[model samples]
Target: MPYEPLPDLATLSLAEIAALNDARKLPPVAQWNPQTSGDSLMTIRADGRWFHDGGEIRRPAMIRAFAGLLRREGDGRYWLVTPVEKQSIKVEDAAFIATDVAAQDGALAFKLNTDEIIVAGPDHPLVARGTAELPAIYLAVRNGCEARINRSTWLQLVELADADLTAASQGVRFALVPA
Candidate 1:
């Protein structure tokens, strides 16, 4: 007997994919798969600034609009997809950076450069990648992308971190959700 594997992606129709991208409230970026037109000369800086054709995109609304369409593929690539086209975009390290952060009730909340607020607590955990002495903080962002914690926010988190963290098992742990 021969064994066959199930196909991925549920085989969504083209029109359905388009409709999904059109609807508001975080379009199904993880689902749609239109043909790749080509790469756009856009690069999202590590500081959460979006640039195109070597010019900084200062319009907050435009950046926010594009940020909504950002997606990460299984092959470790980033793309900005629409109903009809999927354009590749360069990400310096991670897509967005945490511009602001606040703590309340023993949990941390972060505001990303895209103006998306993420409460880093139980549902969306904050994963630390380095020593507590020099930690690289990251918050789970949309579709498997992580937003790096900025310097100021990192400082604040470090100051507020629990003192009982073991040396071997470093990194902040909490959960929040949106992405």
Candidate 2:
């Protein structure tokens, strides 16, 4: 499928963003828990690159397809799940990376490495971690997965923040600096 570019994020209203998110139908991996489980030998590097048996998976379509099947279980494990089986996947850091960001209609819209757009709100909150000197910010994605906010995107958020280093989205205020 051809990837369609979204209209300028800054031009979208909060309701439009919500509607875009609501229209996406993800695979029901949560409902399809099979008894069969095994290692997929797939590793997601800390920088958000996908590799299988030490070989890079270069195709964006394949990566997006595999990303759609990802699930994080109660045991803090990542898996590529299907109705018939589940394959364990190793993740060095976050499963996704927030590659781009925009301040839209009093909300922050994020574009992930997989080209998925999400708005930060109660369901997808921004969390600050790491030390004050080396702060790491993360955004909660679906299925218990998170997207590490990359440096450039983080800077973009900073530019959008108030003097207190906080930003508001969907009536929720988020701290950019780790407490």
Candidate 3:
């Protein structure tokens, strides 16, 4: 049998994506420490564990936050299965997929799917080069603060202060209320 294509979240209108989030059918927001620092550039505790830079929710709490939306199979593993790409990825293991990586502000962002994982190299167009840490940013709108993640530091989280994290991803952003 031929393989079917998954649904692309980016293709949907903002309103449509909002509807999906409203219906609780989308992935839960990842958690980050809001109190750590407000710099866009920061270091993440890549000891194979997620930490909150300073936001409301922290690591373990983040797991609960992502529970249903993104399931944890076993150990400290979580998967994001997207219909559009018909692919699932292990959140912690940043090795399996050869993602196109990029460093913006302080966030080490990856763009991956079934086809490829693009790791943003030094030569990548979006690599942020500087010694001063970027400001710590969060996703905020008329409603309130949404999700938060730390910036990147060679191999750590950069300490950013008073920065806006609205451009974390291309996907529509949403505020996750703890249950």
Candidate 4:
């Protein structure tokens, strides 16, 4: 798919943001139930770099294609699934990084490193981990995958938060601080 610039979230309503998010058509990895399983020899590093067999995958298109097929099982293992095979891939941290964020009309819109946009709401909730002083906030992406809200983006959320350190979006409020 060709790259398109993201619209200004600040100028868009929640409904518009949701439309922009669902515009992209992803693969049906969730519905694929392959009987073959093995290691993919791929790793997503903590800093969001993807490596395959000791070599870095420098192509953005390849990364995006692979990310579309990523799925996380109930056992906490990451896999790249296809119709014929499902291969486990190691993830050092979250599968993707929340690179940018914007507060839309009563919504929190996030931009992932893979150029995917998602709105934080009931279906895609924000989860806080670690400690209050050093929190790790994550946003649910898709198919049980999540994007770790990077430091700068997390700080943006902090600035948007109320006195209680809670950010509200789509009638759901999330605590910025770990509890």
List runs of model 3 lying over 4 Å from the truth.
Answer: 1-8, 25-133, 140-146, 149-179
Q: How many steric overlaps are in each model, in order? A: 7, 0, 52, 0
Stretches of candidate 2 off by over 4 Å are 5-8
Q: Any residue pairs clashing in model 1, and if so which?
A: 121-174, 121-175, 122-175, 123-175, 123-176, 124-175, 124-176
**Please, what is the whole-model Cα lDDT of each candidate in the order they appear?**
0.68, 0.90, 0.30, 0.91
Best by TM-score: 4
Residue-wise lDDT of candidate 2 within 21-127, one digit each (tens)?
Answer: 67767798878889999999999999999999999999988998899999998899999999999999999999999998988777789989987788899999999
Q: Which lDDT tens digits does candidate 1 get at residues 1-179?
A: 23222122124333433344354377777788787568989998877778999999998778877888998878889999887889999999888898766554444556677766666644556776766456677877777788998888766665665564311112345422112
For 1-179, candidate 4 gives per-residue lDDT tens digits of 47776766566777777687677789999999999999999999989999999999999889998999999999999999999999999999999999888887788999888978888989989999999889999999999999999999999888999999999878999988888
Query: CA lDDT of 142 in candidate 1?
Result: 78
Better of 2 and 4 by TM-score: 4
Range of the 10 consecutive residues with the lowest summed lDDT in candidate 1: 1-10
Please give the lDDT score at residue 55 for candidate 2.
Answer: 100
The per-residue C-alpha lDDT of model 3 at residue 166 equals: 21
Between candidates 1 and 3, name the one with more favorable TM-score.
1
Return the lDDT, model 3, position 90: 34
How far is 95's C-alpha from truth in model 1 (Å)? Answer: 0.5
